[model samples]
Target: MANTMTSYTDAQIMKALLTKDFSGIGREFVDDVITSVKVGAFTGAQNLDKVSLPSVKEVHYCAFQNAAITTLDLPWGELEAIGFSAFAGASGLPQNPVFSKLTALSNGAFAGTSDKKNTDLRTISLPLWTGSSFSEGSGFSNSTGGIFAYCTALTSVSAPELQSLPTQMLYYCQALEEVVFPKVSTVNSGAFNYCSNLKKIDLGGAITRLGSAFMANASKVTALILRGVTTVPTLGSTTFNSTAVKSGNCYVYVPKALEATFKVASNWSTYASQIRAIEDYPDICGS
Candidate 1:
């Protein structure tokens, strides 16, 4: 095929979508022509990409399993919510859903909250995401496991605008390596559970609650930096788990004035032997 671009009527697109056929569509379609997409419409197509619907305001329950979509660009200004498993099995996808202008998302819209059946894509970089929480019942809670539980290739997450994290958001992502959440203040349990490759984390001071946030059995963490947070959040029994102490290389750095406070807190005090003041480690910020 020439991979050409052409016009498609709403009726024609709807027909192909309902039949699970893309034989009449092109690799790139114009968004201005598409107004709506039905639930489970594009479930198993193999060659879809570049769906430009600048006028579309919402997309309800759709699937794109094993599709060739690379670099998604949605009409963020009008997009309200995306329903379950929109990109469930697209293993080739290298980046997370890019909600450039949209603000809201629904349950299981990106990946399953409990099972590994729908999430084969890797990486979750919500660059423009700015919210305290996500729709809980939407994805993460419906499944028996975490949202990224089966995303074995997933390696990084960068959500700078978010202040809090959902529970088990990245559970069992064994290959995960780097995380950058500079604005996050709170995190739910098992948020980073079983992320074996993660090495370091840089969290902001607004943090007030933590629920087994960074528990792991094979953790490779060596540096943990908390910037200016005063009152320690509620720490889970396994929040630090095996990461709190390493041979002699691991260090937890807090504000210069609050080192004493951290060393005396309940769960945090358990790692007091490894905790230190930020001034003690001038290189904590990697300046």
Candidate 2:
């Protein structure tokens, strides 16, 4: 009589891998099967030049680390979170993956990579982040770390639900021209430290704490409009003193009710001549 052998189906093997069960399957058997399946799936897929994973709703940590994926087109609108160190050291992938649908990024989501050279990643629309904690050096760093760093063409950003501005979010975006933080309530330190060309900053009536060096060394900021601010904190001896505020030439506007409070602050008092109640100057462009 001829000898007989048992065979397992692909679904059975995949289920075993997912459950981490190797009772009947040998270690080599599992490894060989997984490797072959992955290779075949990647090679047989359509559009090998531009692989688009639209069905992937969530990506865990190190999901694609050290892989050969050169380009990723993640356009899934349902993607809500990216695990920590998810794309860390993914040298083969582009610096900026086109994700027109990604809404949230966990801590260190794209950390530890030296492949950001000549990357054109300028503008991002994070409209869903209501309250998020970005630790010190927890977010993007390095020359390629700024949220919109080196994006020479980036001119404007509109986020209606953004409650806090993370530290170093716009660290070295030298070409940023305008930023509209309509709902921003808190601004951490060094938020816009080295933006040399930043010209217009419109902080709408919701900000409370302006951390140290919030806009330090941003000489090009010609207009600062604080529509509902009651106080401007001091940064050591320098305070909020800039050529724009010291010359008494730059325009400063405040709410009508907070005129007394604004006139009492030492930083604002020096530029008192430049301050005007918002109601009095309805037509002024820079407030």
Given candidate 2, what's the lDDT at residue 126? 59
| Model 2, span 1-287: residue lDDT tens | 11122355566545444543433333212122111112122211221233345445655544443333445555434566555445544333443343444555544344332334223344556566553422224333212123433333344455667767766566656667778787776777767776678876766745565676677667777666677565654423353555455544455566778776766776557666676677786655443
**Highest TM-score model number:** 1
State the lDDT at 146 in candidate 2: 34
Candidate 2 wrong stretches, greater than 4 Å? 1-51, 60-70, 83-103, 107-118, 131-153, 230-236, 239-243, 246-250, 283-287
TM-score of model 1 (CA atoms): 0.73
Candidate 1, residue 78: CA error in Å? 8.6
Report the lDDT tens digits of candidate 1 across residue range 1-287: 11123556667666666665555676545555455555555576545555555566556554454445544555544555554455555433434444555444443344533344434456565566554223335434222124455466677766678776666666666777667678888766777776677777677748887666454553676777777487766776666656635344567777878888888898777778888877777775553
Q: What's the lDDT for candidate 1?
A: 0.59
